[model samples]
Target: MVNLVVTLRKKSQGIWRSSFVRSVAVVASGTAGAQAVTIAFAPLITRLYGPEAYGVQGAFISIMSVAAPIGALAYPISVVLPRRDEEALGLLRLSAYISFFIAALIAVGLWLGGEAVISLLEIESISTLIYLLPVAVLFAAWKQMAERWLIRKKAFGVIARSALANSGFLNSARALAGFVYPSGAVLIVLATVAEVLHALLMLIGIRKRTTIDLSESSEVSTSNVIELAHRHRDFPLYRAPQNTINAASKSLPVLMLATFFGPSTAGFYMLSQMVMGMPSTLVGKAVSDVFYPRITEAAHNGENLSRHILRATGSLAAIGIVPFAIVIFFGPWMFSLVFGEEWSMAGEYARWLALFFFFNFINKPSNAAVPVLGIQRGLLFYEILSTGGKVVGFLLGFYWLNSDIWAVAIFSVVGVIAYSGVMLWVYLCAVRWDRDKKAV
Candidate 1:
């Protein structure tokens, strides 16, 4: 027994000593801190703002979520792929330009038919706040661009600090503002401000720490940006559409619940999603952010990626299963205790959502591997199928079952199956890539 204990300790120590583990720890620590702030303030925030406010905010956020990824035409995600800093800088510039254009176009549309859009979506509660959507989308796009650039430079420390700062400022502001006003518009505006602040912090960090020469004339030139855009055109053509569809699918429940049931129901669903997604934000996202560059480097060196994929998947599964199981069993009780009795329904929604999140939790490695494997086109098709499934499931529950819980339950099941299939496909693709590399 003594020998077994000693051996296990040593093995764990060895694993912790690896660079990948260290990187993940750095990012996760920051994310953990950020999530801690959000969690600490959540009970107070919920009580002050109420479900209807969150539902309004959730509806606005759903629109931003769907539009943000495509704002830069998915080019920001390609930042880590290039071998040269200059090329990466060019991609960054290209993403910024595209994001600005898209935001401007959205603003124009809103100016022309903003009221019509509100009536169409049945979201008149946010008629005044809806104009901020383009601004929020632009901020989100820029934040992602900065984050990807930091990732490419392996500036994980900066990334972590920025997350902490963003969360601290955003939550503190929300809590203070809610104490005075507690309006949905307040939440939406603060969220957008948080994005811009986070982006600026990262940009400043890059200027201070990273060795990349931003002043280099060739890197930020229009021609270089154009060249890089053409070279990575697959992002705009395939990856953009894939991301948009995936975001739409994920946000559909909130929108549908709001339109069919009421904003309060959507609010309950939103709160449940927010609470349940904490684990993914704290660990899964950290792992994905760190793992992306590592796997990209491995692919560039023609190294085998199968082992990395399997190991990451297994580790995430082990880390995520216990908390998710706890939620599955005691979700309602926990939510009632922590968030207030008003949010008990949110807990009910969380129990079913836990099943889907567990799969999503373990699928981060596979999500990171898609771009590395150059399988965006195939993934696009899969997303379409996944989205279609979600729509069918949601509509069935809404029209036939006539229960909000039923709609959420069906949506969760479809998500679980879709993410499971994605994990399998990505793992097989990694295996084939390894085999082909060996043959060469």
Candidate 2:
């Protein structure tokens, strides 16, 4: 019995030490630490800023999220696929230039019609801070580019440390600012600063470790960059639209709740999302970040991917279900306990959102697999359909049921359905690809 126990222990250790598991651990640990900081500071921050301020910040973040994904036309996302460091470097530079141009375009648009757009969204509270959106977008785009390059280098440790540092700085600044001036404007400004800091940290981290001699490399010339852009046009044409629509779908509730119900309501929703999203952010994103390069490599090598996809999905489901269940059952009480009574409503929102987030959590593998499957065009249409469903569900609750909880509940249900469909479709696609590859 003693020998058997020892053997089993060794086996478990070996499994844990596997590359995939180790990579996940590195990224997840950093993310977990970051989330811990955010969680630790939440009570104090919420008390200082209150819901209305959070609502204003949430609205600004929503708009930023919708625009930031496409700021570089999704070129950074393709950075991991290139075989050569020079080519990847070229792609990186191209993405940066495009991001700058997009940022300038955003600035121009804001200069021309910023107030009207703010009025239309009913987010005039953030009117003064809205002009900073372009700068924030640029920072967000740069951060993504830097992170993607780190991912390509398999520098998961650096990526993880940067995430921890970014979260630490952002949350600390927010808490500190709240004590001095707990306005939405302050929150927005600090949030933008956090983006800039994160980008710089990631870039600096890579610069120290990377052996690529960009100064000597003439391969990243104008013509070469254009050629790389053309080669990866599918990202801009398909993935960009897909990502934008997907972001809009997720962010729509924040905007709609603010516009229809009130900013305070949106604030509640935002808090719920932030809290409920912890599991996904901690594990799902780590898994996706590590899994993407592996899946891409497997695809290039004609290896089977369905097994990987299924295994990751199953593992995430097993890990997530219990915590999500806890939220579903005791979310309101937990929120009230942690954030005080004013946040109990946010807990109510979290109860329903837990279901959506569970499916979203399990779908990370599929999300990572979609781009690898060369199905970006199809995915774009699917995103549109999914967004439409979310809109219809939200409107149905608002116009027919006339209850905020019902609206959130319906929106979450639609999200659950949409993400489930994506997982199923991606799994089937992987199976077909594997079968065809074997036949060939």
Count of residue pairs whose backbone atoms collide, per candidate: 0, 0
lDDT of 1: 0.92
Error of 2 at 309 (Å): 0.6
Worst 10 residues of 1 by lDDT: 214-223
Tens-digit lDDT track for model 2 on 266-285? 99999999999999999999
- How far off is residue 384 in model 2, in Å? 0.3
Per-residue alpha-carbon lDDT of candidate 1 for residues 1-440, written as tens digits (9 for 90 to 100): 99999999999999999999999999999999999999999999999999999998998899889998899999999999989787888888888889999999999989999998688667786698898889889988988998999999899999999999999999999999998999888998898888789889998998998887868735467876788899899999999999999999989999999889988999999999998898899999999999999999999899889899999999999999999999999999999999999999999999999998899889899999999999999999999999999999999999999999999999999999999999999999999999999999
TM-score of each: 0.98, 0.98
* Residue 221, candidate 2: alpha-carbon lDDT: 84
Query: Which pairs clash (backbone N, Cα, C closer than 3 Å) in model 1?
Result: none
